[model samples]
Target: LVVRLPLYIHLIHSHIHTFSFSYILGPMLSYFNFALVSASINIFFFIAFLFQPESPYYYLMRNDVDNASKALSWLLKADEDETDKELELMRKSVEEDRQKKAGWKDLVATPTDRKALLIRFLIGFVRQFCGIIPISCYSTQTLKAAGDSFIISPDNCTIIMGIMMVI
Candidate 1:
């Protein structure tokens, strides 16, 4: 929910600025304003990220259980007993992950791995045939082509598409 909400809001803001500037301020100025808005959002996101607590996983990976406990406790609002149990579980999971240590060779080593690889490749190949990328790339133009069919303006249609993608 946290991730989705921010993405939705960002897309909505982007669509609004895109339509407003291109319609009212002209195409050339809109490009400049788009750059300005992008930079501003990036700066804001960076500043906001700085205030977030370091992930408990980071400390756990470094074998700093004390700091991991502290961070996890703060994040989860859990009691010390609960924190200890969670920390132990995380430690075991991390150790197991490190022990597995699979290399690129393992990708084709077994039937299961081969099947997984084939499935992944097939999915990627199929995805390229989907018109989503082209449609997204030329969304404004695509909407403008159907300008008469939509009750709202093409600009609003594009904005709604952006919102829907985020959702």
Candidate 2:
């Protein structure tokens, strides 16, 4: 998990940059160019996913043993015998999960559990009323309105805000 910290950060950074650059381009480029650029990213990901194997669990859940075995073999890079053993283990795990039952009463089963649940609810309630989403959505327009008082352009300020989020 520690080794993947950079990967997580890179994912966040790329997403922020994508949104910031697209927003900046919307005003500067032709409407078609802006749309093409935005759509191209999604198209690339769609094509890439087309070649990837489906989740073995998806096939297993549908009782499709043959496809599940094939997917598991490809994903695990294992031979037939090893794949069969792993598949059996997976089947047992799924069966056990299906046998278990959960209910709303489980949320407050213990004092510690109840405390944690209450804290989570409070945090979510506070977050919803915090106005962060609204603020972020209107930030560019707000910056543009106050741009006359600043040295930098509103577009540059937007990029700065995106970088700050990445940090």
Candidate 3:
């Protein structure tokens, strides 16, 4: 929600400027205003993230059982019995992930690794057919083609899409 809200704000600012709605305030300088606002918001998000909870698994990895249990308790909604069980399960999953992590040689030698490689390959291949490349490269043209459906200008929409990708 935080990520998308910035894109919406950029779009709204674009609309206001395009329509000369902010002409009474000052000149319509887009990039400078957006950059200042985005930087300010990023600072706020960084502070907010500092106050957020650390993952229980992180504490477990550091061999801090007390902190890990506390984190697990919070994560499991303070359900005491479930916290221990879930923490143990998380430990097992983490160990398995560490063990399963493979190198280039293991990628083709192991069946599981080969399956993972093929899945990644297929995802990459399929994305090319999803029209993302052309829509991104020729975004103005794409927006123009879809123009009639929207009340907002295609240029503003394209600008918003760019911001969304950046965020």
- Which candidate achieves the best lDDT against the true structure? 2
Off by over 4 Å in 1: 1-29, 115-135, 139-152, 156-167
Model 2 lDDT tens row, 30-128: 769878988998899899979988777777777888998998898878789989998897778667767878789988999999999999999889868
- Between candidates 2 and 3, which one is better according to lDDT? 2
Cα RMSD, each candidate = 6.8, 5.1, 10.0
The local distance difference test score of model 2 is: 0.76
CA lDDT of each candidate?
0.72, 0.76, 0.68
TM-score quality measure for candidate 3 = 0.49
Q: What is residue 129's positional error in candidate 3, in angstroms?
A: 17
For candidate 3, lDDT tens digit of each residue in 73-141? 865685777888878887886678777867779668978878989998998888789876677556656
Give the CA lDDT, 0 to 100, for residue 37 in model 1: 66
Where does candidate 1 clash, by residue pair? Answer: none
1-167: candidate 1 lDDT, tens digit per residue: 22346679887676566545434433234567867866887799899989877667778889888888888888778788988888788889789988998899988999998999999899788768877667755676777776588788766665566556545
lDDT for 14 in candidate 2 is: 71
| TM-score, model 1 to reference | 0.59
Which sections of candidate 3 miss by over 4 Å? 1-29, 104-167
